[model samples]
Every structure is written in C-alpha cells, then in structure tokens.
Target chain A: EAGVVQSPRYKIIEKKQPVAFWCNPISGHNTLYWYRQNLGQGPELLIRYENEEAVDDSQLPKDRFSAERLKGVDSTLKIQPAELGDSAVYLCASSQETGWGRGELFFGEGSRLTVL
Target chain B: GESVGLHLPTLSVQEGDNSIINCAYSNSASDYFIWYKQESGKGPQFIIDIRSNMDKRQGQRVTVLLNKTVKHLSLQIAATQPGDSAVYFCAETKSSNTGKLIFGQGTTLQVKP
Candidate 1:
C-alpha cells in the first residue's frame, strides 16, 4: 500500500504571496490532519478533519490560513499573503477512525515552504 | 498550555552502545504515547508506542518505558547503529478522543560508526 501523498515537495515564495499545499490520504483513512513544523520544533496541529467535517481547528490562523477537505478524500491548505513566519514544513497525516483514539498515523514527506 | 518536552537536545553514542532519549510531558491526562524517528527530508516514522497502563513495551531493538507516576517517557535503543541516526520525538494524546497529538521538541541521536 502507498503512504500518504503530498504535492510540490518544496515551495518557495515571497512574503505576502499566496501559497497552497495539497494532500491525499491513504485509502480507507477517515481522519486527516495538517501540521506545521518550525525549525528545531515538533509538528504542531493546524487543523483536523474527520470525514469532511473539521473537528478541530483552534490552532489554525484563520486570518491567513484556510483548509478544506472536500469530498472527504483529499485536502488543501492555503495561506493567503503568506508571511515570513510561515516559512516552515507543512505536513499531512492520516489515520483510521478506531473510536479509541489509538490509531497509528501515517505521514507524508511534507511540503517545505520558504518565504523570502 | 501544557506541552511535551525533551530532556536533551542531542545525544551521541557509539555504534555498539545503547542510547536512551528522555521526554517529559505536562499533561497528566494523556493516555497514549508514541515515539517517532525522522530522518533528513522525510516525515516522522513510528518507532514504538506505549499506553498509560503499561510501564514498558519492547519492539525489535527498541524499548519504550513510560513512567506515569512522574509523567516521563524514555526510549532505549539496544546496540545502536549508524543507521539509527535521526531525530527522535515523543508525542502524547489525551483521553478526549480528539486524537490530537502534542509532540516534544525532538532529540537528535548521532551514532558513530
């Protein structure tokens, strides 16, 4: 089986430019997550979707960051007018809904964004 | 907000020696914990996991020890090899069923050949 797949492994843009990242989860996975990892830091949750419904997005910056998982299969994370602080790695992960919150997550290689 | 933290930023060990990485979590309600290994330019790979009810769980050459009493966790690698060089992270999830994981600042493991 193939792992989670992400597009445009690396992205470079100027500050205030718009950028988008795409993710395709593994087959049969009902839960998808988007996380941002700064240098020397662990990946932080930005948003979570459970079968097309966003269950958690408290950590997402709504003013500039937006995400959607249409059809409950693929997801897209967008950053409008990206800021210099947005230069980091964007990771997408997925897990099967086991009801016990013990599901193991599988992640993609991630999209590294560099904002000048 | 409560967060997970690592005791050390880096660790160096001989190829044939053992390596241990430590992590401290502040959330006492966390019920599940996982350890991940990440190489350069790659996503984190699951190494091992342990539940709050268990104190220790062992894999092929990796062991995860959880100390709920102290809110601490540790990963031990036996007969470490150069291929084991990577950043190790410990993550915790609460019982809320959200499946949101809080990860620690990772520890870089460097094994000398």
Candidate 2:
C-alpha cells in the first residue's frame, strides 16, 4: 500500500505570483489535512477536510490561501499573489477516520515552496 | 491558546549511550500524545505514542514517558544509534476522536558515532 502522495516536490515562484500544490491521500482515508511548516517550526494546520466537507479552516488565510477537496480523495492548496513570507513546506496528511484522538495520520513528503 | 514546546533545541549523544528528549505542553485537557521523527527533506514519521492514562510506553528501542501532573512528556532512546539522528517532535491533541495534532518546536538529536 502506498502512502500519501504529493505533487511538485519543490516549487519556486516570484512574489505576487500564483502557486498551487496538490495532494493525494492514502486509500480508504476519510480525513485529510493541509499544513504549513516553516523553517525551525513545526507544521501548523491550515485546513482540514472530512470527506468533501472542510470542517476546520480557522487557521487558513482566506485572503490569499484557498483549498479544496472536490472528490474527497485528492486535494489542492492554492496561494494567489504569493508573498515572500509564504515560502515554506506545504504538507498533506490523511487518516482512516475522524474518531476522537485515536486516528493516526499518515503524512506525505510535502511540497516546498520558495517565493522570492 | 495552548501550545507544546521542547525543553532543548538540540541534543548530542554517543551512539551507544542513552538519550532523552523533553517537551512541555500547556493544555491540561490533552489526552493523547505522540512522538515523530523527521529527517531532512522528508516527512515526519511516527515513532511512539502514549495516552494520558498511561505513564510510560516502550517501543523497540524508544520509550515515551508522560507526566500528566506537570503536563510534560519525554522520549528516551536506548542504545542510541547514528540512524536515530533527526528532529523529534512531540504532539498533543485534546479531541479524542479528531486527528488534530498540535506539535512542539522539535528537538534535533545528533548521535555521535
């Protein structure tokens, strides 16, 4: 069984440009999450999806960041007019279910974005 | 807002010696805790996990000790090896059924061979 997969392992863009990252979670997983990790910092939750519904997005910057999981299996995170501070690794994770605290998430290698 | 934090930013230990990493959490309601290992240019990998009810849990060569009273957590690596060198993180969650994990700053472990 393959783990979570993400596209464009690395991305580089100039400030004010648009950038997008894609993620494909593990099979049979019903919960997916998007997180941003900066240098010397842990990954912080940006958004969370239960199936196709986004249940948690309080931490997401709606002004420039948007995410969607149309079919519930794959997800895409987009940042329009990316800023220099937006440079970081975007990680995707998935779990079997949303059952309390028992769900163990499987994460992907993450997509590193560099905005100049 | 509750947060998780590591006591040290880095630790250096001999390959054959024992190593310990410490973390402190602000949320007393957190019932679940986990430890993760991350290497350069890769994702975090699960190492071990322990519940609030248990004080200690041991894996192959790693042990996780949880002190609910002080809201502290620690990971102990026995007979540490060079391969164990990586950034270790401790995460906590208050939602028993949700998968939301609040991770600590992380501790860089450098095993000297």
Candidate 3:
C-alpha cells in the first residue's frame, strides 16, 4: 500500500515562466486536495476534488493558477506566468471519503518550487 | 528548510520527556480535528486525530485532546524523541466540507538532544 506520490520533488523557474506540478493519490481514495504551503506558514487549501469533479477552488488564484483531475486518480496544478511570490511547496493529499471521522488527509512529499 | 516565523513559539523538551503542544481553532462548526507532523522538506504526516464528539483520543504513544468549550486542541507525545522534532499543525474540518481541514498557524517543536 503506497502513499500519495508526487513528481519532480523540486522545481525552479524564473518569473513569468509557467510551471506545473503533478500528483497521484492513494489507491481507493475518493477525495484529493492541492495545497500551497508558504514558508513559516501552514498549508492552505488551493483546491479539492471529489473524484473527477472539483468541489472547492475558492482559494486558488484563478487568474494565474489552474488545476485539473482528468481521470480523477491523478491531478496537475499549473501556474502560468509564475511570479516571484509563487515560490512555495505544493502539496497533495487524499482521503478515504467525505464525512465525519473520515477527515484524516494522507499527504505526499510536496513539490517545492522556487521562482527567481 | 522552511523559514521559522520571525518569532516562533518554541517548545523544547528533554529526550524521554512528555511534551504537549497546543492550538486554537476559530471555526465552531468544524467537527473534526487532526494533528500533523511535518519534517524538513516533507509533507505533513498524520500523527493522530480526534473528533468533536470525544474530548480525548489516544494512540500508540500519542494522545489528542480537544476542548470544544474553548475551541482548543492539544497533542501529547509521551517519551518524546529527537526524531519527533518537527513542525506540528492542527487543522479543523467542517461537517459540510466533507473533510477539507482549515489548518492552524503551526507550531515548531524543538527536541533538545
């Protein structure tokens, strides 16, 4: 039973460049989430997906950030024209279901992005 | 390495000592809470969780205490070890969001070797 897996453990890009991060959640998990963790701060929810549909994305920067979970099992987060302030760890987490007592989110080693 | 906030409230404990970390949540509707341990460069790992129904829950060597009255939560680690040192975060989830947890400001635990 492997945990969530993310690709390109680390990434670096310049300002105005586009960057993308990928995530693969745990098996049989029906819910997936993408979070942005800034230095010295806690992880903030960027978006959440239940199966292939995005249920929550209010926190995501719609003008520059976009995400998709085409098949529902894997997800990708993209930031176009990345800004210097966009540097942060992009984390992905998954859970068994939605409801009480099922709120434990299993997280993957995040993808760290550095924008110069 | 994640830069420590200008002045992180630190909790230093001697090896083998018992440690307690506290958190305050804002949302009253949040019915679920979780404790996560995040090592350097790694994602937050679940340490333990407690539902709003129960005031306290215990795991192998860890315990989570929740106080709905004060909207406070605490994580207790028995026989703390150096490996247990990391940034700990407490998150709350509303019963409606299914399980989207709103995380706290995080606390950094420093275990004195």
Candidate 4:
C-alpha cells in the first residue's frame, strides 16, 4: 500500500512564469484535496475533489490558479503567470468518501514552488 | 480563515516529559476538529481528532482535548521524544462532507533531548 505520490519535489521559477503540479492519490480513495502552505503557516485548502467533481474551490484563486482531477484518481494543479506570492508548498492529500470531509487524510511530501 | 503569521508560537519540552499544544479556533459551528503534525519538507499528517460531542480522545501516546464552549483544542503528547519535534496545527470544519478545514496558525514543538 503506497502513499500519495507527488512530483516534482521542488520547482524554481521567476515571477509571472507558469507552473504545474501533479498528484496521485492512494488506491481506493474517493476524495482528493489540494492545499497551500505558506512559510511558517498552516496549510489552507485551495480546492477539494470528490471523484472527479470539484465540490469546493472557493479558496482557489480563480484568476491564476486552476485544478482538475480528470480520471478521479490523479490530480493536477496549475498556476498561470504565477506571482511572487505563489511561492509555497503545494500539498496533495486524499481520504475516503465514506469519511467524506470528516476522516483521516494521507498526504504526500508536497511540491515546493519558489518564485523569484 | 484565521490570519497566520510567519512566526508561530513555540513549545519546548524535555524528552520524557509531557507536552501540551493549545489552539484557539474562532468558529463555534465547527463540529469536527483535528490535529496535524508536519515535519520539515513534508505535508501535514493527522495526529488525532475529536468531534463536538466528545471532549477527549486518546491514541497510542497522544490525546486530543476539545473544549466546545470556548472553541479551543489541545493535543497532549505523553513522554515526548526528539522524533516528536515538528509543527502542530489544529484544524476545524463545519459538519458536512466537503472536508474543507480551517487551520489555525501552527505551533512549533521543539523536544529537547
């Protein structure tokens, strides 16, 4: 039983460049989440997907940030024309639909984005 | 969402001693609470959880205390070790299936050997 996998572990780009992250959830998990953790701060939810349907994305910056879970097992988060403020760790997590939003989550190491 | 600063409150304790990390949440409607441990260069991992109906829940060597009246939460680590050094976060969510969690400013736990 492998845990959630994300790549690449790190990325460095200049401001206004485009960046993308990929995530693979654990087997049989029906819910996936993307969270952003700024320096020294707790993670904040960016979007949540339930079997390919995005149930919550109010916190995502629609203008520059977009996400998709096409097949329901893997997910991608994209930032177009990224800003300096976008530098942070992009974390992907997954849980059981049975727990819905109330269960334990397994997380990946996360993709660290550094925008200069 | 709660405002977070770059500097987090830190708790230091000696190894083999008890450790208590406290968090104050603002949402009274939040019924589900969770504690997460995050090490450097890693995402958060769940430690323990408590619902509004319950006040205490214990795990292998950890305990979570929920005070619904004041919207407060605490995680207690018994016989702390150096491996327990990490940033601890407390998250709350309103009752639903969205899994939208509001996280507080994390507390850094430094266990001294």
Q: Pick the candidate with the highest DockQ.
A: 3
lDDT of 3 by residue, B1-113 (tens): 12232223567888888888888889888888889999998899989888788999999889999999988888889998999999999888876565678888788888887
Q: List the candidates ranked by DockQ, beginning with the highest.
A: 3, 2, 1, 4
Extract clashing residue pairs from model 1: none
lDDT of 3 by residue, A37-97 (tens): 9998999999999999999998999999999999889999999989999999999999998
- By summed lDDT, the worst window of 10 consecutive residues in model 3 chain B runs over B1-10
Q: What value does DockQ give for candidate 1? A: 0.57
Alpha-carbon local distance difference test for all models: 0.90, 0.89, 0.88, 0.87
Which of 1 and 3 is ahead in TM-score? 1
Worst 10 residues of 3 chain A by lDDT: A97-106
Tell me the tens digit of each residue's lDDT in model 1 across B1-113: 01125477889888899888999987999898999999999988889888888999999999999999889999999999999999999999864573688999999999888
Model 1 chain B, poorest ten-residue lDDT window?
B1-10
Candidates 3 and 4 compared: the better one by DockQ is 3
Q: What is the C-alpha lDDT profile of model 4 across A1-116, one tens digit per residue?
A: 99999999999999999999999999999889999989988889999998989988999999999999998899999999999999999999999853435657888999999999
DockQ of each: 0.57, 0.62, 0.66, 0.56
TM-score quality measure for candidate 2: 0.95
Worst lDDT run of 10 residues, candidate 2 chain B, spans: B1-10
Which parts of model 3 have CA positions greater than 4 angstroms off? B1-8
Better of 1 and 2 by DockQ: 2
With candidate 1 superimposed using the best TM-score fit, by how many Å does residue B94's alpha carbon deviate from the native?
1.9
